[model samples]
Target: MEYVFTLKYQLADEDRDHEQIVERLFEAGCDDATVGMGQPGRIALAFTRDAADAWSAIHSALQDARKAMPSARLVEAGPDFVGLTDVADLAGVTRQNMRKLMLAHASRFPLPVHEGSSSVWHLSDVLIWLSGRGSYPISAGLVDIAKATKQVNLAKEARQIEPRFNRQLVPLLA
Candidate 1:
């Protein structure tokens, strides 16, 4: 099983190079970490780890990142989930084909955690099913990395949409 955490931080100043900070974080043992520039003076970091050791992995990564770069200040961090598009991409199939397979073999395929316009599932469940399918030319390591990347991207999209809608004013919003 794999777990993903998306973290946001504020850069100390313009002189603080974002790429350099990312490099340092990676060197500090964040092997599955990806970093991107967010708003001005802010950056986002995504980290992935096996579920069995996620708590320790994240704690260690945070400690190492802080030690390596004192100027970086953590803002928020949380887990992220993946959806059908992510599964299709990871399995090297079109979304339509993936959905077809799922529908045809509903007994074998795991049900999604959230079933709406875009169904969501835990990365581990998707990877486990994909690993058993001979059509997918993917390894365990690749699945872990891909799952992390997908979760991070999904979380970013959700964050981008949240600000545009007001929960009180839009009661029927999906």
Candidate 2:
């Protein structure tokens, strides 16, 4: 037999809410449960269980949920902007595929936005696009530009570091 168990936890400082977080866990086999607020900013939760074996099942579910949400604290901030990258992330698609999906479903979506001569899409518009033909649930939230910028910077730094190692190793090999 299987049972569900929920553990309440506090959110971290740099996190935001992720709406699809819970549903994804539930879909992954989290048993009957509910989550809410407790002291100050802490979270409270309830889980159901029919046997002791359910503990492992519950832990697996929680781990999956944590991976999806990452930060409990920010799970409530919601998405702000829907960039092409963000759309790709939510749809579990590649950038090229996302563009394909958009183009293939253009007639289904509302007219693309034209801002300063370039086409743009509102977050809501993307949600509509997902609703029309997507199999997964769409969550609302904006791309964290600051985080994205940092990632780009980190990638650039890594490329710079790679040459230093290669240059030093090339002498050793010769």
Candidate 3:
């Protein structure tokens, strides 16, 4: 049986660079995927089961792509996190800028549940959030083979994106 891995993505105002977005998706193993129609910031990538499986092989591609850039953290789309980092790995930012953007974003994260005495985000929440772009500002990195089994609340959040369940991978956006 062939599985269609439909990758649906939304762009924030800051992510206006189409080249960058394409590069990121390509590195994420969406190369050769046919683009389905959507709003300007949103796109649907249709991939064959074989290509989707390559996700695991190219897991580290995102981090590798971001190696030269500072403040760039990986976002994931799967059952391994809530929202990941609050900070963007960009240059020429000041202390005040960091505090301003990051501070509010932390609280914006979905309520993390308690595992024992510690509060940790669940991979399940991350997956659900990815399924529904009801939660924005979520991100992930390319998959890492060595650490494929390991689930880091933030790291895995970047490497893999949770996909839509419906036949058409479009966000309800309500």
Candidate 4:
């Protein structure tokens, strides 16, 4: 299986030079990725890697990235965060249609991670829903990758949770 995913990071000052960073990443086994340095202090690696499973593909890429730039902070693992338009585009439907589906199936629709004027959902959630609905032509590989990315991203973010605070917070959250 070939998993396609993007890992975005906040680069440390030591990793400032674009050319050197690219070289280092390549030497560290991220040759499978296309590195993008579009924003200052940030780098994005888009990878299309072959592995037996989606988790292995993303896990290896993340490990390779760590070897290349140990100081870089992982910012996001995407296609994990998306809006209705993004889901619609992936499904080859209009944004309005996607919204209508959500509205029509409000009870079964996956909850958005963030709710605002611009709501965002984990792509795997929407893809799964569409697959259940049938006739969406959604790719199983993409859904698998999305699920793996979402899990990886959540685990990364979970590092920030203070165990004592969580012990207190978890009860309050309910």
Clash totals, every prediction = 0, 15, 23, 0
- For model 4, the run of ten residues with the poorest summed lDDT: 165-174
Residue 154 Cα positional deviation in candidate 4, in Å, after optimal superposition: 0.9
Q: Clashes in model 1: which pairs?
A: none
In angstroms, the error of model 2 at 98 is 0.9
- Tens-place lDDT per residue, model 2, 25-88, is 4664543657555455455445553433433444454555566445652221113234676777
Q: How would the candidate models be sorted by TM-score, starting from the highest? A: 4, 1, 2, 3
Better model by lDDT: candidate 2 vs candidate 3: 2
Off by over 4 Å in 1: 1-34, 39-42, 46-59, 66-80, 144-174
TM-score of each: 0.51, 0.31, 0.28, 0.95
Model 2 TM-score (2 dp): 0.31
lDDT by residue (tens digit), candidate 4, 45-163:
99999999998998899999999999999999987999999999999999999999999999999999999999999999999989999999899999999999999888987899999
lDDT of 1 by residue, 67-172 (tens): 6667776665543356878778877899899889888889989777698988877765777787887778666655554454445445545665655474654577
Q: What clash count does candidate 1 reach?
A: 0
lDDT on C-alpha atoms for all candidate structures:
0.68, 0.50, 0.41, 0.93
- Model 2 misplacement above 4 A: 1-80, 115-118, 140-174
Indicate whether candidate 1 or candidate 3 has the larger lDDT: 1
User: Please, what are the lDDT tens digits per residue for candidate 3 over residues 50-100?
Assistant: 323334433433333243222333333322332233222221345365346
Best by lDDT: 4
Task: Show the lowest summed lDDT stretch of 10 residues, model 2.
Answer: 140-149
